[model samples]
Target: MKTELRVAAYAVCVRDGEILLARWVDREGRKRWTLPGGGMDHGEEPVATVVREVEEETGYVTEPTVLLGIDSIRRNWLRRLAGPGDWQGLRILYEARIVGGTLRNETGGSTDLAAWHPLDSVTSLDRVELVDIGVQLWRDRPPLGRSRLTDPANG
Candidate 1:
């Protein structure tokens, strides 16, 4: 079987010891905080995709300063939000600096609100494992390139 691959870009925005995050409400009305970004569009550059996603999701104009690292995650189809289907995604993480724009909620977007949380208190919030990875990349940037085996399925 041919494995399907998806390419996504995400941004880690930090300022004043706080990290910017988007709160997404699931179908059950439970909220989860995640980085500001989304899947890359055809012919879109990774950096460009991150910039656009951040602005669209959080209303902040950001510039990706550096490519933090790439995460290759594999998960069962049923365990994913997309329902049962095997998935392997290559996520490009970026360290970004907010340059302009005011913060606003993205109406009709996947996220319900955007806010900054204390870096140390991020663990207290309900977040995905990818959030932890982004924080680590921001706190202690690894040697770059690709970082694999991130998802539990591959472990």
Candidate 2:
């Protein structure tokens, strides 16, 4: 099987009971609420990637204040173009604070909308698993930076 590895960074920006999120358009053309972050560019630090991605997706200037955690997953899938392959994803999660910029949706990007959702309603939304992980990390703050309460099925 072909193998691939992806490393991405994400931010969990919560303030006054609201969490900032971006609506990501997946390969299947379905939209899912996710953190305001994405894959890292070549030679870019994960910190830099999170800052840049948050600005691009949510139009918010952010500073990652705390290292929330890292989530790693592996899956096997049949891709339409790349055929069957094993994919590994390393997702770095950070606790970020909005320092500047106004809220706006990203244009010509993987995500279409950016909005703030009340923390209590997040679980009811159509969101990716990363959202849960990020929130859990922010709440529990495990020393190892992992969420023990996250659903295994979601990963």
Candidate 3:
């Protein structure tokens, strides 16, 4: 089987009582809430990737204030268009602050909508596991730069 690796950056932006989120549209057209970030471009630093991705997905110019954690996952992509393979994802999480721009949905992107949701109600939304991981990392601030909670979906 082929082996593929993907490195991405995500931001956990919390203000007052809300957390910024983007709606990710998957291959099946199912929409799920996710952190405001995406994959890093070639030769781009993870910090730049997070900054750019937040702006692209949420219409907010952000500055990463702290490196929260890194979440890694591996899965078997049996139906991958590029052929069956083992895929590993390295997700870098950061605590970011919005510096400028207004709240607006992205156009012609992987994510279609962006909004702030009450932190208390985040678990009720249909969201990716990364959302939980990001929040946990932010809230706990584990010294190892990793979340204490394991992703059940990945296991």
Worst 10 residues of 1 by lDDT: 145-154
Q: Estimate candidate 1's alpha-carbon lDDT, on a 0 to 1 scale.
A: 0.86
Where model 2 places Cα greater than 4 Å from the true spot, the runs are 150-155
The reply for model 3, stretches above 4 Å from the true place, is: 80-82, 151-155
Taking all chains together, each candidate's TM-score versus the true structure is 0.86, 0.94, 0.94
Models sorted by lDDT, best on top: 2, 3, 1
Q: Give the TM-score ranking, best first.
A: 3, 2, 1
User: Taking the tens digit of each residue's C-alpha lDDT, what string does model 1 give over 1-155?
Assistant: 33578899999998999999998777888889999898899999999999999999999999999988888888765544555676798889999999999999889988899999999999999987778889887777778544433645446
What lDDT is reached at residue 116 by model 2? 99
Q: Pairing residues by index, what is the TM-score of model 2?
A: 0.94
Candidate 2 weakest lDDT stretch, 10 residues: 146-155
Clashing pairs in 1: 77-84, 77-85, 78-84
Displacement of residue 23 (Cα, Å) in model 2 is: 0.4
Task: State residue 143's C-alpha deviation in candidate 2, in Å.
Answer: 0.3
Q: Model 3 — TM-score against the truth?
A: 0.94
Q: Residue 29 error for model 3, in Å? A: 0.5
Residue 38 displacement (Å), model 2:
0.5
